[model samples]
Target chain A: METVILMLGWVGVFAPVALGVIGSTIGCSRAGMSACGAMLDTESGYGKFVGISAMPSTQAVLGIVVMFTLNREINTLNAPGIFGVGILTGIALMLSAIHQGNSVASAINASKNKPEIFGLSIAPAAIVEGFAVFVFVFALVVSGAIPQ
Target chain B: MNSDQYITLMSALPSLGKTYHVDIPPISRFQLEKRLNLLTEEHQALLSDIESVLHWDHLNSHYDDSELIQSATLVLEQLTHKHYDTLREMILWRLNLRTILAGLRYRQRGDELNHQQSHWGVGDMEAHIETYWQHPYFNLQSRFHWIASVQESLQKNDTMQVERILFDVTWQYLQRCSSQHYFDFTAVVTYVLRWNLVSRWSSYDADKGVEHFQSLMAFALGEYQQLSMGIVVDQNGDSK
Candidate 1:
């Protein structure tokens, strides 16, 4: 039972980074493909499309930070807390990144034609990112309460 | 269904604005065909099936009503088997339009309603249309108000007005569907359909213009020849 708990602790510690990376990869690829497509239609503003494609990468960075914060000596006492917080945070981050990527892709598509609305188009993506930040910050706060 | 497979393709397609508002499609036929090459082989086949059923040229008038219904039924079955809900809905919409319009034309010509002729339409509304054949708008004015105007225009023998109303209604319907879908197969389909709308409209205009110009030229030339003949006849009379 002790060994199982410790193993779970390690899995939890790594889960955020692994899941976050996977999510970011999917999100970035979706948005990047859309950006590449939009580039074919427009004459200028290629830079902005490329920039929008990178929006999903922030979740990966946040995941790395959460992993480091949770990386302490794992024991039976802290295992459950770490497991719960890490897994939940990872799921939230992953979902948010995926949906944010969809928003970014839509933004890029819309703005490619009507350049005047570029800023407004990205607002939805920014809102999705905000949800991810909420999960990241709360996960860190909860991790501090776990037993050393 | 996951639309991720088509994100790039859908995004790459240029927006086709409102049919009446646009003078020409933003992309040329050659450019559009080139972009369509990005679709997968399976998707290409599916799209070809869709076009074969709905495209103006493919729906030849010479094909009797029964033949069109057979082909449309087969295509609808294929779309259903593939689980293409949007495409199926679009095709059904078109079939409904054809049924309603055919009913109107038949009624306009004072033909008796023939319920036995099931080949007139391919969908569930055939019975309803036959039942309401004597109604001015086939009793569809409550649901499709535009049918009333179309019927009125047809009665007046204003073919151009009827065409305009049909184009506008079709354009708006496709536009509404397009807005609900993005980065998906439905979006691509709607875009292509709208492109066809624009191309057809422009060509129709051009053809009408050429027809008018030819008629005007014929009248003017006829008047000139008549005057010339009269002048020669008068001159010969004076000489004699």
Candidate 2:
């Protein structure tokens, strides 16, 4: 019974990455293209916007790494706090990555008619980032590693 | 037509649908000269400071807010041209190199515009004003597209108009990056993200430029050294 359960946990760990990438990649691509496309008429001062969209992927990458750590920890003994960390971090990571698309969409809308005030568009993306920060903090609590 | 006529046309509107005109204040010579004086003084101090912090050939637009940079550049134009003969030739020489560098900036990427034209000829405020209005890229297109749109807005003015265009275009660029429309990416970038492959990689890089971005920064910084009094610190007050 334990052996089968361990096997299932392993699959669960990797599956989110595979599925998340598949499910989110196209949508993310769409949102990003729309945001950058808003500057079709003007190309100056756009590097900042393009720069942030590139950053949201870190959420996805962290989620994948967390999953592997989860699978290994779960097989060892199911330390309850680790499981909580796994689930919460997973939820936070997925949610942040998905929510970033909304900011991307809003940024596109704002870009077209008001290029000068585009810095304000970062507000939404920053809010979505709170979840990622939470995950990082919680992951640290569960792992409890001291700096060398 | 001369620059005044061009300025008048730019500040007008697209009456017939194709040709456009932008509007500006009907400044008498005295008023133009006064405003020009204030603009010049403000920029000299700022540029002098910038030269202290940032190195030439390593500038980036995002380092300084575009709003701050644009206003500074406009001021610099006024200072270098208006009453410039009253100052040292060295200042004008520095201004010339700065302008050329600013031109390459696409808008202050490296804290330097790639338009070093101050030394190219002898001129007062009027000539530089004329030159500014005469340039097809900054004058005809940018003013017509960005300035006119903001001017049409009930509450917008010249400064507001520039800000509006910059924000609108920048926001759109963000959207295009999110969506991954390859063509749109090409269209929305400065020289750094000009190619599709660069866009592909930049979509996820910590910084947006991929590889060419570094090269672009180098170009802008190189120009800053000419006008800035000393080594210019980047906006962050960090050495590059």
Best by TM-score: 1
Q: For residues B65-119, write the lDDT of model 2, one tens digit per residue.
A: 3444444455446545554322223233334323432342333333333255332
Candidate 1 regions exceeding 4 Å error are B59-61, B114-118, B206-240
- For residues A1-148, write the lDDT of model 2, one tens digit per residue: 8776555555545543554454245336545554454433344645655565554576666667666555555562453445445555666666676667556555644544466656787677777766676775567566554111
Judge the docking of candidate 2 as incorrect, acceptable, medium or high.
incorrect
DockQ of every candidate: 0.61, 0.01
DockQ of 1: 0.61
TM score of chain A per candidate: 0.98, 0.69
Q: After superposition, how far is residue B17 of candidate 2 from its true place, in Å?
A: 18
Docking quality class, candidate 1: medium
Native contacts present in each candidate (fraction): 0.59, 0.00
Best by lDDT: 1
Q: Residue A92 deviation, candidate 1, in Å?
A: 0.8
True-structure lDDT of candidate 1: 0.84
